[model samples]
Target: MSSTPTTFDVRADFPILSQTVHGTPLVYLDSGATSQKPQVVLDAEVDFLTRANSAVHRGAHTLAGEATELFEDARATVSGFLGARPEQLVWTSGATFALNLVAYAIGNATAGRGPSRFALAPGDEIVVTETEHHANLIPWQELAARTGAVLRSIPVRDDGTLDTDAAASLIGERTRVVAFTHVSNVLGIVNPVAELVALARTAGALTVLDACQSAPHLPFDFDALGVDLAAFSGHKMLGPYGVGGLLGRSDVLDDLPPFLTGGSMVTTVTLDEAHFLAAPQKFEAGTQPVSQAIGLAAAARYLEGLGMDAVHDRERTLERRMMAGLREIEGVRILGDASGVERVGIASFDVEGVHAHDVGQFLDDRGVAVRVGHHCAKPLHARFGLTASVRASTSVFTTDDEIDVFLDALAGVRPFFGVGA
Candidate 1:
């Protein structure tokens, strides 16, 4: 409560917060799923559709030219936002697609194209974390399945932080690739990427980072963190859906082969063979999500204007407030380190007597929207002896009042269900 941010009333910017969900004003606590769009972002999309709508990097028409310029500008915006050069960023459908591209691209390299830097032999290892969202886990699983490689994971402690001791023992000479989330989507635990990356580097392995949760909540410098490649989605950061970024080291990308091939990504295409475009252009494949990219860039600009530090500060305040509120409730056991350094506001808790789904229903009836169930990290839930938990996440646009509404509704859920006092 002491750290609650009062300088800015972020609730004013999201118009939808004014409406009723089930007889009460909507208290959206689901930014971890997809953040609510601000007026600036909405207008960016509208303006693109209204004033400048056309294919990019292909058409010579005025609209096409304008759209292309805006789209690339967005690319530049996102690239700069991530502390990467413009050429380092490749647009994708979402973070999942971005991640899938990496796994598949490296698989192609192993098959023979360029240096074959990622060939997964029978004994090679692909390392991941137990808390990874399926997006980061399944691609590697499929890659390992395709190759004869074995998939290994770093264990999570009871507090939800990565088990560095286990990581040191697991990452060995045969470990060819290391991939983990910068921040866990379900637990809100921020992985110690710097320490982990150092471990990966020492093992001479390639590193991939899932920054889906980190990018929106805090500023990130991929280079400083020493990750070989990273991915993040726009929807989680108040940008249009279907727009995400994959950032990889320029040299590393040059070695990995393309996953998807078609128009616009080629330098030359013959009837029997084709030469590829440079790094990012080579990866962009088809006509890109032009408008979505433009909106996403606008979102980047908006976040930058507000200052990433400010955004981080606000979110930290909210996290503490939320943690304090959850701790005050009876029968609510929070599932994370709670050490403050390795955590954020995306909190999940198990109610002693009520089922997670039932709790969700009760919250919904009272107009408090919270995510319930496994939350796409089934393995992490399994590790914690849980099938599901109630999750409430916050964003910069979330206000203290909305959280209060959610807590008030949450407190009433058990009594309404007749499960607990």
Candidate 2:
């Protein structure tokens, strides 16, 4: 495979894209919600289940060994994809669980069982941005409430960019943890992660990132970013559902307590207490998502083979085209700063004189799939005086024709609703 896979080749690998919706060809533009999977990812999961099906790390049998090897190899593959070590990744159900693990572990530590380095006390603060998904926002909010720590947020500027100057001011010595999204799931704008991380470091605060919107689209080196921890989901990255990971600095994972405990995570168990395994294993309990992990590894490999620089460049062109198309449609106001800021291929907007749901149904009728509603970032929508908006996101498999179809469908929405000029 070359550094850049052609769009036709990429689209061919995804079987579902060949289908039709309401008698029109399916023009999928909702990659931000969850990406459609490729044949290789699907094949990987089935191959694992059919041949090497067994409990990982528990049995001494041959099948168990094969399963364990495949599972661990997947870990190594995914870790390498993120510029991390296998020891630094912990498997979870998805990004939501990954974020919860960090928050819950901090809460548990503050209750006096885990490391003091993670414990939060009164007057200590946790900072996040206004544009965070509820997955990132609520967990930290609950953590602060549980630990008596105050929660602070860096407000978003009018253009949908984060107010980094305000973040620098709010993240003082009292701030214990600083969490933010690498890209806004709603606004489609990229945040200044390095700047925010530097601010948090200057205040001696730990940093966490929600990378669910980034890992599949960009080449990520977590260690290079200088964050203490980050989480992302596999399903959003052309991988299977029900599996994701928490990638952290080894020192931080060593200090944090296990969020879940049961079989396989233990080294020794007395009648009263148990000794847990090392960092990655200590955090993974019960039967693991073996097939999902293997599939996700394949997805990572598929992305790497295509090369992230090429993926980013293709998506940048698509985003510019989509943005320009949206601007031509009167009353279709984009939700964020419509300037020369950087963003992924996510375009979210509100059409005047039409409810988001109505616009969404109109699009669906025309076989154009777009994400509607708050997108789990209600606070971000509330900032724009909107209860909801429509989002059309792109991926490596997205085509120019699909984008044009979406724009055409959007242009017809108002006229169909009898609200045209």
Candidate 3:
């Protein structure tokens, strides 16, 4: 594969893109939903299962030792990818579970199980943005309900960008926690993390970032971003399902109480009382996702080899091409404003006189797969006066030719439905 900034020849690494659908070459534009795994990631899981298939940190046998080493090594690799320490990252089922873990841990704190700084009192505010995915929004809603905290949101502008002035006003002395997404799944626009973090800091609020979209496409560093906590999913980053990570500062994790408690996380146990382990282990109870973590580490290595800067550049080129093409088509209303803002290679649009499902099916018939729905973000869609829209997202394996094919298939949607341009 070439190493140029504007070109990516890494499509061959993903075997799923080679097959035909409906007698046409498959053109997958739904990486924002979930990315296709490469051959190396698949091989990593199979190799670990075949060779070191023992429960980690359990028995003193050779297989157990090997399994434990491999598992911890996987943690180190993923932590390096995020520019975080291994001790600061905790494994969970996915981003949903990670966010819930933080919320529930804070709830525990409120119940007098941990530090008072994390505890919420009556009239305390939990702030979120209008563009948040439900994963980032609902947990806070539940947390606020459990505690006496109030829930508030910063509104989005008509162009789908966040209203930063409103955010500055909302994140004042009453704010306890501020959760937002690093990138919008619906609009693909990158949020202003530095500005938001500064606001939260000035107000003495905890900043929680949803990095599920940025981790796969950009050069991510949790330490550099200065967020108190962040969550990301492996499946969205060319790894397997059933695994994700929650990253936090060492002090923050040390202060958080355990969300899930059981075996593998206890230091000492009596008939009536038990002492828990440290963070990362305290949060990870029962059995862990072993082979899936190995596969995710392999996926991280693959991205590192390709260089994240080059990947971002190539995707930006594709995004510009996609936005330009969509703008030229009549009756295609894009969801967000693409003028003078940083974004990823994702475009959601609505076709005139046709349902989003029909548009998706039309593209699917031409072997172009896209996501069509509210995309688990009903609030963002409702903000735009839409219940659903068609979304096309790119990945490291996406090609210029594939983008062209997707744009051409989209241009034919209105014509096929007999809607006049």
Who wins the TM-score comparison? 3
Cα lDDT listed for each candidate: 0.88, 0.92, 0.94
Model 1: per-residue Cα lDDT over 275-337, one tens digit each? 999889888888799889989988898888878877887777778778888888888888874
Which runs of model 2 end up more than 4 angstroms from their true locations?
1-8
Model 3 / residue 139 / CA error / Å: 0.6
- Pairs that clash in candidate 2: 159-337
CA RMSD for every model? 1.6, 1.8, 1.6
Q: What is the clash count for each candidate, in the order shown?
A: 0, 1, 0
TM-score of 2: 0.98
- Order of all candidates by lDDT, from best down to worst? 3, 2, 1
Worst 10 residues of 1 by lDDT: 1-10
For model 3, the stretches where C-alpha displacement exceeds 4 angstroms are 1-5
Candidate achieving the largest lDDT: 3
Tens-digit lDDT track of model 3 for 1-421: 2355477678788999999999999999999999999999999999999999999879999999999999999999999998899998999888999999999999999999999999999999999999999999999999999998999999999888899999988999999999999999999999999999999999999999999999999889999999999999999999999999999999999999999999999999999998999988989899999999999999999999988888888888889889999999999999986588889998999998999999999999999999999999999999999999999999988888888999898999899999984
Better of 1 and 2 by lDDT: 2
Q: What is the lDDT, from 0 to 100, of the residue 324 in candidate 2?
A: 93
- TM-score order, best first, reads 3, 2, 1
